[model samples]
Target: MELSEQVAIVTGGSRGIGRAVALRLARNGARVLVNYRRQVAEADKVVALIREFGGDAFAVAADVQDEYAVEAMAQACLERWGRIDLLVNNAGMSWDTPLFRMTDQHWHTVIETNLTSVFFCCRAVLGAMRARAYGRIVNVGSLAGLFGNVGQSNYAAAKAGLIGLTRSLARECALDGITVNVVAPAYIETDFVEPLPPLLRTWSIETNPMRRFGTAEEVAAAIAFFGSPAASYITGQVLAIDGGWVMP
Candidate 1:
């Protein structure tokens, strides 16, 4: 019950790491708003699971890249819970293409989805968080942002931008009792990595000291820590949940 009576908004909460984070927060006693752009059914399933466990949660549809949609989503949270205590910017999309083959659309789509959406969602909740003098903001990033992965230039750039945003926002909100941090996971065992080519997947596992891809639940545990009061003194930091990969 670390987050008892708190309200959390988790983007991309329909599946993968986002879904795990939403469930974990709810398990800690937070009323959760599971946000998804598509996969309405998946989002509802997450909600159902939380409710079945006697936790409070509901699904809200929002394209996080759209400023208006993000605003409406924030409004919905406030209307239902009276305040927003945590915001997890976990909604992201990946486009894997070599730098030479990357088009403007490819670059923009990844940047907008992974980076711009964080801007929209963070700004949307800042007012309420500042007013309350308490907030926890955790942005989900990736190892590519830290160690530069081949064919993931757009993704790396977007996640790198997110790290910068996290640090700057942490400084700006420090006086307001709001903490901002990032969780960067590498090769997590989610649908996001299921399509990796055989050789690439082999390389992913062999290169890591742990010799395995991390699980969505493991990444969620790190996120849950950042979102909890236990981490109030921590901010402007990046924690890598990569099973010994990207050791920087």
Candidate 2:
């Protein structure tokens, strides 16, 4: 767990689970590059907090859905840190809607933001990681992708695609000492869930086997484990932090 001097990037690190992962990695001694799309202020705030905690961190703005932007983000990190040891594809976008109600724009947006972004970022870093023969990649998926939540067809499809991406990348990178995995979190009490209607929120809470929502810190720990040296042998797998909501 001594990741001192390791350079890592956590996409969507402006808030919620992404922010928590960024902070947790920093605490574990990684120089963090926090990426955000539109939340410049919030992303900067996370960077400030990381610095306050005596960790090396900085904010980088990029729309993950854009290939050029993702490539530049990776380039910036490499230029500043020399190399990247860990990559957490935590940036995602989603809006609930039934299948018939999902517009072309809706479907494409969700798929591009959630699934395509992972591909772009991972591709941008894979060459460098392969050249060095060292890397760790963790994708942040959702239980909704596994259980097929209603009114979230777009989200489910995109997240399911991420799992597939994780597996394929793991297979390709394993021989190079790169391990890729996914962390699927359910009903975390973040701003994303905080605004849900009372009944929906209550249902999500009570449905958890633990009778409560998982915390961002809990999910962060799972992400960190996959990215750490301790998990060198674990790859092409999904770890669920769902309060036992979707036990295998």
After superposing candidate 2 on the true structure, give the runs of residues whose Cα lies further than 4 Å from its correct spot: none
Quote the positional error of residue 113 for candidate 1 in Å.
0.1
**For model 1, which pairs clash?**
none
Candidate 1 per-residue C-alpha lDDT over 56-154 given as tens digits, one digit per residue, 9 for 90 to 100: 999999999999999999999999989999999999989999999999999999999999999999999999999899999999999888877899999
Q: Every model's Cα RMSD, please?
A: 0.6, 1.0
TM-score of each: 0.99, 0.98
Model 2, position 35, has a per-residue lDDT of 98
The residue-level lDDT of candidate 1 at 144 comes to 86
Q: Who wins the lDDT comparison?
A: 1
